[model samples]
Target chain A: MEPIAVISIFVLAVFVGFEVVSKVSSTLHTPLMSGANAIHGVILVGAIIVADHSSTNLELGLAVAAIVLATINMVGGFVVTDRMLEMFKGKK
Target chain B: MSRTLYDLIGLAAGVAFILALKGLSHPKTARRGNMIGAFGATLATIVVFFFVVAPKTGVAHALPLHHLGWILGAMAVGLAIGVPAARKVQMTQMPQLVALFNGVGGGAAALVAIVEYLHLGSGATKAEVIFTVFTVIVGCVSFSGSIITFMKLQELMTTRPVIFPAGRFIIAATLVSVIGVGGWVVAALGTTPLLILAGLSLLFGVLFVLPVGGADVPIVISLLNAFTGLTVAASGYVLDSVLLIIAGTLVGASGTILTRLMAEAMGRSLFGTLFGAFTAKPQAATGAAEERPVRSGSPDDVAILLNYARRVVIVPGFGLAVAQAQHTVRELADLMISKGIDVAYGIHPVAGRMPGHMNVLLAEANVPYDQLEEMDEINPTFSQTDVAIVIGANDVVNPAAENTPGCPIYGMPILQVANAANVIFLKRSMRPGFAGIENELLYDPKTMLLFGDAKASLTKVVSALKAL
Candidate 1:
C-alpha cells in the first residue's frame, strides 16, 4: 500500500474520532482531557522506543529529541493542571 | 501481510476513541471515554512503531537504548509530579492546570520539529526550513503563554493586567524582529541558530500574555490550546506522521471553536484577546464592606423561606467546588424534594474554574444529569422560581453581568438569578469573585446573605428544612 493511502486512512479515523468526542456533553470534558493527558505520556515512551531502535544517527537523534519534548509536555501539563485545581480548594 | 488491514484497524480505533471522548462529556460516562481514548492511543502507538517504523528499518535497529531510557524516565518523573499534585490540588485551579497542560503539549510538538530540523544538518531545503520555523514559533509561544497563565492562575503573578507605556508596540516589534531573525537563521545558518531564535519567540509569547487581565485567562487558555494543536500538526508534517497530523488538526479546530465561544460569553472581541486590551480600572479597592448592603438572614428565617418555596434552583460556583459541598448540597436538595418542592440546579458555562465544574461536583453527589440545566435553559425559569439558592457562586450569577453597564463583567452572559422572587447567597464572607468585581446581587432588596462555611451552612439549611 502507498504511504499516502495509509496516512489518509489514519486521518479519516481521527476525523471520525473527533466527531464522536464532539457529541459528548460538556460535563465530561474535564475528566476526558485529564485521562487523555495521561495517555499522551505514551507518546514519550514511543519516541524513546523509536530512538533506541534507530540504525542511523539521524533517526536516533530525532527520536531522542522527540522523547525529551514529549516528556516535558506530559509532565508539565500535569503539574500546571494540579496547581490550577488548587484554586478551588477550601472555599466557603 | 496486508498493511492496509492494519491501517484500517488503526483508523477504526481512532474513530472509536473520539466517539468515546464525546460520550464521556457527561460525568457518568467520562471514565468510559478515558478507557476508549487510552485504547485508541495504544493502537496508534502500536501501528506507528511496529508496523511503520519496524518495516522501514527491515531488521536493522532504528534507535538507541539510551533514548528508550529517556522516555521511561520522563514518564516516571511525570507520574511522580502529576499524581501528588493532582491529589493535593483543589478543583478551583483546574482551568489553570488545563492551560498549563495545553502549553506543554504545544511546547513538546515544537521541540519535535526543532529536533528534526537539527538532524537535517547544515544545508536543509527551503520547505523543510519553513515548516521547522512554523513549528518552533507556534510551539514556543504556546508553551510560554501557557506558563504565564499558570502563574497568573496560581496567584504567583498579578491577576491584574500588567502594562507598560509601550507594551503593545514593544511586543509587536519583538515578534516581527524574532520572525525576521528566524527566517535569516533558517535561510543561512540552518537549525542551530534557529534554536536561539525560538528562545526569543518564547520570550515574546510570555510578554504577550502577561499584560492580559485575569478575567481574560479563559479565552487566552483556549487560544493557546489551539496553538498547541497547530504545532502538533506541524510536527506531523516534519515527521511524516499521519496520526499526529490527524490528532493535531482535530484539537486545533475544536480549540478554535471553543475559544470563540468563550470570547462571546465574555462579550469581548477576538481582537481584544489578541491585543491584550482591557478597560482601565477605577483603582478604588471595593472590598466586601464597600459592596452593596448585605441583608443577613438567620437559619430559621432561611428555613421558613425554603419551607414555603414551591420551586428552587441552586447555583453552585467556585465556592462550592472549594468547599467540596456537593454532598451536603445534595442532601439539602433531597430534604427539599421530600417537602414536595421541585428542586433543580442552574449551571453557568464559565462557573467554577473550568467548564463543567458544577456538573462534576454534582455528579460526585450522585445527582441525576436531568436535574442540571445550563444557564440559558434555566434562566427563564428562575423568574418563576420561589427561591434561587446560590451556593458558593458569585460572578456567574452576578446581576452586574446582566444590567450594570461599563462593569468588568457587564455584557458577559450570566444566569439571571436576580429575577427570582427571593435570593439567598451562601458565602463565607463578602469576597469578590475571580474577576475581582463586586456582586450587585448581594445588595438587592430581596436578596439574603447567609455567611458561613458552605458545607456547614448547607448542613444547617438541610436540618432546618427537615425540622420545618
Candidate 2:
C-alpha cells in the first residue's frame, strides 16, 4: 500500500472513532474503556506474523512470548468486557 | 485460498468492530455488541493466521512459519491464564486488572515490532521502518506506563505524586533523546538504535506517570490505552493489515475522547493534569491540628433519622467499594422503600476509581438502573431532600469544590448532598479522601459522622431498620 493511501485510511478511521463513541452514558464508560482495550489486541495479528517469520531461536522465543501476551490481552479483555456488559444488560 | 478473499474477511471484521462500538452507545444492545466484537476479533485472527501468514507461497513466504507448535502453545497458555482471571477478578479490582491487561497488549505490540525489525533487517521499506520504530516507541511506553498505573491502583506503590526537582525538565530531555534516536532509526533502519529508543521510551513512560496524583490515574489509564492503540495501528502499518489499522485507530480515537471527558469531569485541562503538580490538601494552621467537633451517630440514630425522612439520597464513593458495602447499602435502601420513603442513589462521575465504577458495583448487587441518578440529575433534588446518607463518600460531596477559591478541586462538579436538610457521613476517620484533601462538608452544621467500616455500619443500620 502507498503511504498516502495508508494515511488516508488512518485519517478516516480517526474521524469514525471520534464520532462513534461521542455520548456514551457514564455507566457504560468502564465497559467502553475495557472494550476499546480489547480492540488493540488486534496487534495479536502482528504477533502471529512475528512468530511465523522468526529465524533465530532467541527471536522465536520473543515472538512466542508476544503471541501469548497478545492472546491473554485479547481473550481477557473481551471476556471481562462481556461480563461487565452482562451486568449492564441485566439491569433492565 | 485467494488473497482477495482474505482481505474481504478482514473488511467484514472491521465492519463488525464498528457495529460493536455502535451497540455500546446504548445499554439495550451492549451485550450483543460485545459478542459481535469478540466474533470479529476471532474472525480476523483466523484469517490472518491461516490464509494470510501461514501459506508458504507468494511474497508472504519471506515471513515463514518456523514452528507451528509455538504459536498454538502460546495461545493455549494465554487462554489458560486469561479466561479464569477475567472470570474471577473482584469488581473492586477491575480498574487495575484492566490496566494490567492493557499493559500485556502493549508488551505484545512492542515484542511484535522488535521481532519484525529483526526479521526485516534493513531490507524493509522506508515506510515500514518508520512505522516499526513508531510502534516500538509507543508500545514500550504504554507497556511501562500501564504497569506503573496498575501498581499505583493496586497500592503496591505510593499513590501520591512522586516528583523531584526539575522533573518536567528530565521528561523533556528524555523525549527529545527518544525523538533523536527515532530519527536515526528511520534514516538508517538500524536494529541497534531501536533497542535504545525503546529503552528511553519506556523510561519516559515511567517519568510521565510518576508525578500524576492518584485522582488522575483513570485519565492516565485512558490516555495510555490510546497510546497502546496508536502502537497497534503502527504495527498494522508495518504488517500491511487493514483490520489492525481500523481497530487500532478506533481505540485510539475513542480512548482519546474518553480521556478528555474524564479530565473535563474534574474541570481540569489535559495539559494541567499532565504537567501540573496536584496537592489538594489544605495547609494546617500553626502546624497544630485543632480538633473540630462532629456529631457522632450510632446505627439506631441513623435508623431513626431514616425512618421519618420523606426523601433520601444515598451517595456512594470509592470508600464504599473498599468496604464492599454495595449489597448492604441496597438492603438499607430496600427497607426504606418498604416504608414508602422516596430513595435514590447519587453517583458522581469520579466517585469510584474509574468512570462508572460505582454503577457497576451497585448493578452487580441488583440495584435498579433507574434508581442510580447521575450527578446532574440528582444534584438539584438534594436541597429538597429530608436526609442524604453518604456511604463512604467524602470528596464528591465536599462543598469546597464549588464554594472555595484556591482549593485544588475548585470548579469540579460534586454532589450537593450538603444542601440536604440532614447529611449522614459514614467514614473510617477524619482523614481526607483519595485526593488527600479535607472535606469541610463534614463540619457542616446539619452533618453527622458515623465512623466504622462501611459494610459493618450499613449492615447494622439495616438490622436497626428491620427492628424499627
Candidate 3:
C-alpha cells in the first residue's frame, strides 16, 4: 500500500510501453498515435476522479483544473483531427 | 497484497499494446495489430483502475459513484461524436483527424495541470508549482497549435501560409514576452498568473501556425503531436502518476522523431517550418503557361510511348493517394511488366502529405517493397529510364525545387524525373501543388502531360498500351 510501490509499478509499465512503441515503423505511426490520443482520455478521467475526491480546497481546485483542461484537450484534438480528415474527400 | 505481481502484469500489458501497434504498420497485418493493441489498452486501463487505484486509495474513494457517472457520461459523449464522425470520414481525411485528436490530448494535459495548480492554493510546494506551470504552458501550446493545423488542413482557413507585414517578428516578440512573463510568474507567484500565461500561449499557437501553408501541415501536425506528448508527460510529473509520465514520454519522443523525419523529407529545416508563409492564389497563375505547352499528350500517345519503352518508372504523388489509384496503378504496372518492360516505382519521401505516403499506397496495391525506390535510389535510374510515368505527382518531381530561388519550396528535395528520356505527367489539371507554386516539370521538353482523372488516365494508358 506504500506510495513508492505504486509509483514503481507505474514506472515499470511505462518502460515497457516505450519498448513496444519504439519498434513501430513509420507507416503505422499515424494510426497508432491516433489510437493513443483517444486512450489519453483516460488521463482526463483520472484527473477528474482525483480532483473530486480532494478533501481540501487546494486539492479540489487542482482536480477541477485538471478536469477542465484535460477535457478541452481531448475534445479539441478530436475535432481538429476530424477536420484534417475532411480534406481528402471526393477527389477524383 | 501482491502489488508487485499486478504491477508487472500492467507493465507487460502496456508493452504488449505498444508491440501490437507496431505490428499494425503494415497493411497485411494491420487489422490484427489493431485488435491486439485495443485488447492490451483495455487490459492496462482495467488493471490500473482496479489494482493501483482501488487497493491503495481504498475502494470508497477510488470508485466514487458520482465520478464514475462522469466517466461514463464522457465516454458516452465521446463515442456518440467520435464513432459517427470516424465512420463518415473518408480515408483521405485521416491526417486532419489525427491533428484533432492530438489537440485533445494536449488540452487534457493542460487541464490536468490547472487542476493541480488550483489544488495547491497558497500552501503548494515549489516542485508542485513548477510542474504545474510547465504542464500548462506546454499543454496550451500543443492544444492551440493542433487546432490551427486542423483548420489549415481542413480548408476552413487558407491552406496558404498567412503572413502579415511583420508576422514573423510579431510572433517572435509574443513568444519572448510570454516566456518571460510566464517564467517570472511561475518563479514568484506560482499558479495564480498561470491562467493569463495559458491564454497568451493559446494566442501564440494560432499565430505560429497561421503563416504556414497547407503544404507544411503534416510536419506541423507531427510537431504538435510531440508537444502534446511532452505536455502530458509534464502533467504526469505534476500528479506523480507513473503511467502518465511513461505514456507521455513515449509519445513525445516518437512524435518528435517523426516530425524531424518529415521535415528532412521535405528538405526543410525545423526553423523554416515555423516561419514559412503561404498565400492562396488561384492555381491558374501557376497552371497557366503549362496548359499551353505543346507536349500535352492523349492516352493513345502515352500508351505508344509506354509500349516502346524498354524501361518504365512510375512516380506517385498526393494526387494518386487522393484518387485512391493504387490498385489501378498496380494493374498498369503489372500489365507493363508482362510486356517485358522493366517497371519500377520512384517514391519521393515527401511525395504525399506524409512520409511514406506513396509507399503505403504502393504497398496496398501489393507492389513489392524492393521495387519501390526512394528518391535518391530512383533519381540516378531516371536518367537511364526509357519512359518515366508520373501519376498525379507534382511538387516532388517539380524541377522548381532545384532551380527556383525565393520560392517557398526552394531547396527542398525533389525527384529528378525530368532527366528521363520520356516523361508522362498525369493530372486532373495543371493546378499548383500543396506548395502553392507552379511545377516547372510540366513544361519540360521530354515531359508529356496527360490531363484527366488519374485512375481514368491510367486505365486509358493501360488499354492504349494493350493495343500498341
Among all candidates shown, the one with the greatest lDDT: 2
Models 1 onward score TM values of 0.82, 0.95, 0.81
Tell me the tens digit of each residue's lDDT in model 3 across B317-337.
878878888889988889999
Recovered share of real interface contacts in candidate 2: 0.81
Once all C-alphas are superposed, what RMSD does model 2 give against the true structure?
2.3
Give per-residue CA lDDT, model 2, range B133-223, as digits (tens). Answer: 8888888888899999999999899886787877768989999999999999998777789889989989988998988877788889999
Question: Is model 3 an incorrect, acceptable, medium or high docking prediction?
Answer: incorrect
Candidate 3 regions off by >4 Å?
A1-45, A54-92, B1-40, B51-62, B84-88, B184-192, B276-294, B368-370
DockQ values of all predictions:
0.25, 0.77, 0.21
Off by over 4 Å in 2: B52-58, B62-64, B278-290
CAPRI-style class, candidate 2: medium
Superior by lDDT: candidate 2 or candidate 3: 2
lDDT per residue for candidate 2 within A11-81, as digits (tens), equals 99999889888888777788888988988887887888778778899789999999899998999999999
lDDT preference between candidates 1 and 2, better one? 2
Full-model lDDT for every candidate: 0.67, 0.85, 0.67
Superposition error at B214 for model 3 (Å): 2.8
Q: What is the TM-score of chain B in candidate 2?
A: 0.94
